[model samples]
Structures are given as structure tokens and as C-alpha cells.
Target chain A: MIGGRPDMVDDEHRLKMLMVAGLGGDEAAYRAVLGALARHLRGFFRRRLASRPADCEDLVQETLLAVHTRRHTFDRSQPLTPWVFAIARYKLVDWLRRHARQDALHDPVDEWRNDLAVEGGQEADTARHDVSELLGTLPAKQREPIRLVKLEGLSVVEAAERTGLSVSAVKVGIHRGLKKLAAQFRP
Target chain B: MRTDDLVALLARGAGTEPMAVPARVWAMAVAGGAVAAVALMALMLGVQADLAGKVSTLAWWGKAGFTLAVALPALALITRMARPGSHVGRLPVALAAPVAALWLAAAIQLAGAPPGERLALVLGKTWASCPVWVTVLSLPLLIAALAALRALAPTRLALSGAGAGLFAGAVGALVYTLHCPELDPAFVAVWYVLGIAIPTGLGAAVGPWILRW
Candidate 1:
């Protein structure tokens, strides 16, 4: 019953069985599961960081490494997505935080602007830095939704799909975040 | 890393160390903890003064039964969560409902009782020490349970730790029943629940660090 994708529920069941089988030491199943997860992580990272497609592969690798290293922590009796994505999301946030600071300190004006993409890398960097600062002023509940909807230009339904919140909940988060941002900025 | 290279790398090292089935690990850990708690209580605290007369009452059974009831689901969740990416659906509500029902029942029973007596009902005699003893008694079980979980993968370390702590708290409360003569449902609802919560909190606090691979 989640947004835009009917396959989400099936993926949950498949991932659970795959993980359980993998934990039982089935090598083939384990590979299949990780491969499937790698694909999912690629899409997951790509959607949130559309402006930074080049980094998605690295994020996927990092998340996969986390999954592999922390494999023992998965619960065999629970749905797999929340657990897997929890790590992916954690990695994504960490990546953002680390990158956010470097981008803020460096001036992008000196960098070459690529002509092919709709927005140049430097423009994206400036836009992202400004967005990150704006978002940083809000709490995570509000900040995440604002980034997904207003900054990344995802539809409310799309943002809900990414964040696992309901459409209404995402809307509410954006509303509340903007309210707080507005209050903070007003004279 | 491309998917193929990652897959090849992951599969090369893809094997779990052989370990006991999850059920067995759960049983041994829970049983070991329960035994230790009971033994510690007997060695140090002995039975409550009027236990002989009170042993046959429903209140005594309620005390034991309440703890066992809460412990079972927590044990199942902890055991299941020991494996990576597994879920124990609906088990959390299973743990919470009984606690809620007892509190509601206690409120109804004490509704018409004198106001001062109501205070007596909630505090009982061991209010001060009950929570502390529950945590103390829970230590062995919590240790053993965490040890059991260590062999398996647990991504949600804090949650797994809380489950272990809850399991220990329940069993500790079960053992404490031997020494605690508090018969009022209100007393059990308040103090005994608090006792269970102590380890659950401690587990959450330390879970991310201790259960980390």
C-alpha cells in the first residue's frame, strides 16, 4: 500500500527470506541477496542525490560494506527493508554531513562549469550548500522532507516513497519545517 | 564497486560460522538467567516473611504469571532479532498489552478504596529497592543473553539489547516474586513494571556499544 510501487511489499518478503537463507550459510542466496541490495542501494542513493550521481556508486559500496560487516545484526524474523535501509540512510546522512562541510568551505567559482548537464557541478554545489544550510537550521524530521521535496524537487508522493513516511506525513513535515524556517528568518 | 565485482567479493567470503539454532540459544540464555536470578535471591534475600500463608493465593500466581507472560514475547523477539534482517511482527504489542491491562485492572480495583490505602496499594513495601534489585538480578541474564546474541548478526543493537534487557527484567521480576510479598495488583503494575523497565533502559543505553560487531 506504499506510494508508486506495488513491488515494495514483495521486495520486503524476498529480502527477508534471502537474508535468512544467507545467514544459514547459503552462499548462492547470499550473493543473490547482496546483488539485489546493491541494485536497490544504487537507486536509493541516486534518488536522494540526483545532483550527485557520480557519488551514488561509492555510497552503494559503502552501504554494502556496512551490510556485510554488520550482517550479524539483522533479525531473521523481521521485515528486511527497514533494517537494510536504516543502514543505507545512516550512511547517506554521514556522507552528506562530511561532504556538506567541504563544499561549504571551498569556493566553486574557480571550478570549471560543465556545459552538457542542465546545471553545472559548481552551480549544483552552490545550490546544494545553500539548501544544506537552510535545511540544517531545521530538525531532521522537517529537514529531510524539505530536502526531498523542495530542494531535490521530488513530489510529496515521491518523497514519501523515499522516506517511508506517508504522503500526509511528508507534507506535514515540510509545512512544519518551512514554518520554523520562516519564524527564524522573520524580522 | 560495480555490482559484479561486489558480488564476487561478497560471495567469496560469504559464510556464517556454525552456531546453535536460534531457539536453543534463547532457551539457554533465558533459562540460565532465570536460574541465576532465583539462586541469587534465595542465597541473599530468602522468601518474604508471610510467604507460607500467601503461597496458594491468586496474587502469587499473578505475580509469577505476569512476569512469565511478558518474558515470553521478549525472548522470542530477542531470539529472532539475533539474526540479521529478521522481524518479529506484532510481538511488541504482545509485550505491552499485558502491562497495560494490568494497570487498568489495578485502577478499577482501587477506584473505591480509601485515598490513603491507594497510596499503600501502589508503593507496597519494596518500592525503593524493587527497581534496583530487578536490575541487579537482571545482570546475569542480560550478560548471557547478549553473549547468545553475539554469535549472530544484529543490526539494531540497541533494540536487541532492549529486548535482552526486557527478557532479563521479566525473569528477574519472576524470581523477585519469591521474596516480594506485595499482593496488590496496583503494586505489581507500578513497581514490578518499573523493575523491568530499568534493564530495558540500561540495555538501550549500552546496546549500540556492546552489541557492535
Candidate 2:
């Protein structure tokens, strides 16, 4: 196991280094951060957009572009993640606005089908892994909120902002989604 | 996880990619600095005229030294506020005014202003007075110095403000020292104290509102 404080300090320093590099316009540093953040971005879009891969990719691109244009706005002293995610959240909202479909207003489901794919390999693992399958069984309305807020680690406020729902609406979606996921697991 | 493993993961997974700055931004930074310098010069002239009219009792050097002493506490305040982790946000900045005020008060007491004058007179005098012009001019020079720093402040208001304030105070004090008369504890306590206090107070109060993105 790694020691904690040093790791923390080191992480902080690396974060600073990334900010400095971005500020200084270093291409290598830019690519490094982009590569690292891509998974999170994809996950973010996946959870919020539900099944809309194209919309998610479009948002990811837009967010990246905003990051580029507003890079100078970043304070070298602040945390990089919060700032980036704040931008990402805003971009997601913008995306939702531009592409407002009749489907978006519906309740979010708790679809976790990808997690269930892991269960196909073995029966013993499958029983233990039923929770993932159950989560996948949730409706899209519930699944989307759960995936975005819980799996992707967005704050309720942020998830609401990005998904274009009221804070209470998002909370309820999570509550209902979780109830269904729990019931499915037991059943 | 091992330190190396965690490090690798972190390095691999940094916050986001670095964004390229356009040539225009750099040009804007330089242009902004130049403009601020010109405005500061005008303000400095006015300040000097105001100061000279108020403090006829003391020699030019005395007034200059007093101003420099008052400006010192700003250094600590500015440095602390400029760093990322600093909580020197709006409330904190507002809260900091009293400390600056206290420093100004201490400077005046230390400066030993002439017996006939009131403490408020020392601080309230315009920067445009005869010898006071020397100190007054420092404000513009301060503005110019800060203008250059603005390039670094696009999104980081508090840091930028702190950097600008600290820098202006330090440079202003240094210049004042060369031209200022010998230091008197009494002079430092009064004029110098107020000089720093007023600006810091203004900055603390106005910084948040003006700096928001």
C-alpha cells in the first residue's frame, strides 16, 4: 500500500503541472490529459445521453473545444478537475438545449446491461453478479440518472444541470431507480 | 496501490488536455498593460498634488517613508491570497481589511506625525501634493506592473488581485525607499499604514465582484 500524504502532495503537484503545461501551450501535456480524461468523458456522456452515442460524442467534442478556447480562464492555483467538469457540465446543458428531443423529458431508467455482460462467463460469478444485471433491467429513465450520478460520480446539482432536469427531479429519479435496482437484485 | 502505480495512473489520467493559446491573447495582454500604465500615471499625478497640499508639516522624505511602511502588510496579504488553496475569496478579502487597517494605524503611530495634525488627515490627503507626487507616481507605475500581471489572471481573480496588489506594494515601496527620507516610527504608523490599508480594503471589497468570470 502506498503512503497517503506523500501521494496526496504528489497528486496535487502533478495537477499543477498539468495546469501549467496547458497554460504554456504544451502539445504533449495536452494530449496526455485528453487521453486520460476521455474515459470519464465517454462515461459521462454515456450515462446522461442514455443510448445516444452521437449526441454524447458531440458533447464531448464541444466540451473539449470549450476547454481549448477558455483555457486562459483557468487559474493555475485552482483544482483542474473541478474547473474542467464545470465546463463539461455547462457544455452538456448547452447540448441538451440544442438537441431537445421529446424523449429527453421522460424519467431516467437504471440500465446497467454492460455490467451484466461480465456474468456470461461463469454460473458462480453470475449469481454473485446478479446485482449488475438487475441494475441493467431498470427503465432508461431511472438507469440514466443512476449511471450519471452514481457510476460517473457527478454531483446531484451537476447531473441535474447536465441532464436538464430539476435538482429534485434528478433526486427522485435516483431514488426510484435505486428502489427498482434493489428489488430486482432480491427478486 | 504502489506509489509508482498510483503516480502512473494519475499522470495518465490528468484533469484535461492543455489548450493552445492564440497569438491574439498574448498581444492583448501586452496591450492591456500599456493602457493601464498610462491611466496609472494620470492618477499618480493627481495623488501627489493632493498629498502635498495636506502634509506641509513634514519633509518630502518623511511622507515617502511613511507610505512605504504602511504598504508592507499588503505583501503578506497579497502572497497568501494569490495562491490556489487560499480562502481569500470575497468574504475573506472583506475580512482582511481590518488587518490592513490595523497595519496602517500602527504605521502612523510609528511614523510620529507632527503634533498639530490628525491621523485621518495623514491618510485622506490627495496624492498630488509636492513631494507626495513622488509617491503618487508610484501608483501608476503600480498599475503598469499590474497590467502585465493581468495576462495571467483570466480566470483566477483572487490570485491575480493578490499578485497585482503584492507586486504594486513591493515595487512602490522599493521606489519610495530610494527617494524617501529616513524612517520614523511615527510616520510609518500613520501615512504608510493608511496608504496600504485603503487600497487593500478597496481591493478586498471590489475584487470579487469585478473578477468573476
Docking class of 1: incorrect
Candidate 2, residues B89-201: lDDT per residue as tens digits? 45446435644654565466645656566444443433323234333534554454344333222234444455444445434444443333334434444444444444444
DockQ score of each predicted structure, in the order shown? 0.15, 0.05
Best-performing candidate as measured by DockQ: 1
Candidate 2 lDDT, A80-170, residue by residue in tens: 6656666566556545654465336543442244334533543320123233355578877667666676566676778778888887777
Model 2 docking category: incorrect
lDDT of 1 by residue, B1-213 (tens): 244554545454344633445566767877788788888999888878888878899878877888999998998888777765466799989998889878887898699788879888788887899888878888899999888877555667889999989998998888888888788888889888999999999888888778754
**Alpha carbon lDDT of each predicted model:** 0.74, 0.47
